[model samples]
Target: MKESIISVEGLSHKYSSSWAIQDIGFEINKTGILGLLGSNGAGKSTTMNIMCGVLNQTKGSVFINGIDLRKQPELAKKEIGFLPQQAPLYKELTVDEYLLHCGYLRQLDKRMIGKAVDEAKERCGLTHFSKRLIGNLSGGYQQRVGIAQAIIHKPLLVVLDEPTNGLDPNQIIEVRSLIKEIAEERAVIFSSHILSEVQLLCKEIRMIDQGKLVFSDTMDAFNNYVAAQSIRVEMDRPPAGEELLKIEGVTKVEFLTARSLKIYFDGDHEVTDRIIKTSVHHDWHLREIFFDKNSLDEIFAQLSNYTKSVN
Candidate 1:
């Protein structure tokens, strides 16, 4: 089993009588990216703040690398690097100066701070603009500088809250690539409202809604959640839904527009073969037979609606 680097047990938070997050439990393995997904006001930020030691959990506990956050706050926090939705930066300071200051604040040895600063700059692709004031840099470069500061001390976990919130399309791609490159070593806990971004970047996804966890699964399992075991059969004459559903291993069928029938199988490729055999037996001219792919956005929406109904 993979060792869990971050663990939460019955973690809950509230504001007066209202709950923000209730009974949230999950584990993030080392060296993997976890997409902490939720819509705005879904308590994703609240959960992240609690995990990073920015806020005390109203109930339950958080463990970072086996160290209980409540019991050993300092030790647990030292392993975490947090970047808020707004990447807090010293506007007047140059990128290098700010990063060096961050390294020192992380308590790196005087001799090592310089080396760490250099590494952070290079890794974030900020070396070219090292001497530029953070306020003068473009939005993308400023974000990079923000990342450099967060990783200056090389913590075991990096938490980014809406890291690409305001970036242009090209800038978003650059930042996403930077995040993937950074995740090669440490575990990354990222929160975003962008479903496609999570699908493209994260290995595992934790979806939350109205302050409660809705589902947690790997990308493959998530795909399965939205995807029916269906084969898209293209033919000269599209079969009716009921007619196709009657085929062996087929649980359901939907007419997707005109010539495409999404034939849902009860199980494996055996159903696909059955569909093919049945189609041939029916004298239906088959053109193409392939699995129907589900987009992450559809799955996200379905889960969101389910959460709302349960709440």
Candidate 2:
């Protein structure tokens, strides 16, 4: 089995009496991308801070590559690379100088620092811009430099918070591709409020709401959750909502248009066949039928609302 790069257990943090995060826990194993998804003030940054040793948690333990963060902070932190929402850069420094400084700061041996800088620059596509001043690079190139700095020490785990936050569409695409490329070697924990981006990049997801974990599962499982609960039927003439609800196993019907209806139902393929047969018998012109899978945004909204209602 692959070794876990990071493990968080019962992690909680507070500022004064106000809790920033409560009982947040998860593990990153193997080489793949995981997403921390939440809205503004939902404690993503707080959880990240604790994980990266920037803030001590009020309770619980964090282990990076099996070293306890609270007990062996220096050793634990050596295994992590973090890129905050705002890219940390020295505007006056050239990309090469900045990355060299990062390598030295990470305590790489003088002999290894040059090799590390060269490798990071190649991986991040910054070789051509190595001599250029960071203040003169485009937003996308600057972000690449930030990423290069994070990986200069070859950490086992990378944590990126909203890496694409300020980029334009083309820049977002470039950064997204770069993130995926980096994850090919080390585990990555990406935090973002952009639902589509998370859906696109992450194989697993952990969603936070009101400072608590609301959902944690693989992407396939989340997709199955939406698929198992809903169906969509398109007909030339849709039945009335009451008539559709009368079908056994169907709990609700939402009319999407004059010809399309979204049906919520318990697990019963028989009920779907019945709907098809009924449509055919009534000359309703059944045109299409399929499961109505919820988008990540829809799932997030539902989970957030449920969290609010429960609290």
**Cα lDDT, all candidates:** 0.87, 0.89
Clashes of 1: 0
How many pairs in model 2 have backbone atoms within 3 A of each other, for residues 3 or more apart or on separate chains, i.e. clashes? 0
lDDT (Cα, tens digit) per residue for candidate 1, span 1-311: 54468999999999999999999999877786899998899999999999989999899999988889989998988888999998989999998889888987788899998899889999999889888899999899899998888888888899999999999999999999999999998999989998888889997999888888998888778877865455788888767778886777778777776887777776577787877788799978889998877677778788989887876
TM-score of each: 0.84, 0.89
Question: Residue pairs in steric clash, candidate 1?
Answer: none
RMSD of each: 3.7, 2.8
What is the TM-score (0 to 1) of candidate 1?
A: 0.84
Residue pairs of candidate 2 with colliding backbone atoms: none
Residues 276-299, candidate 2: write the lDDT tens digits.
888888888999998767787777
True-vs-predicted CA distance for residue 16, candidate 1, Å: 2.6
Index of the highest-lDDT prediction: 2
* Least well predicted 10-residue stretch by lDDT in candidate 1: 223-232
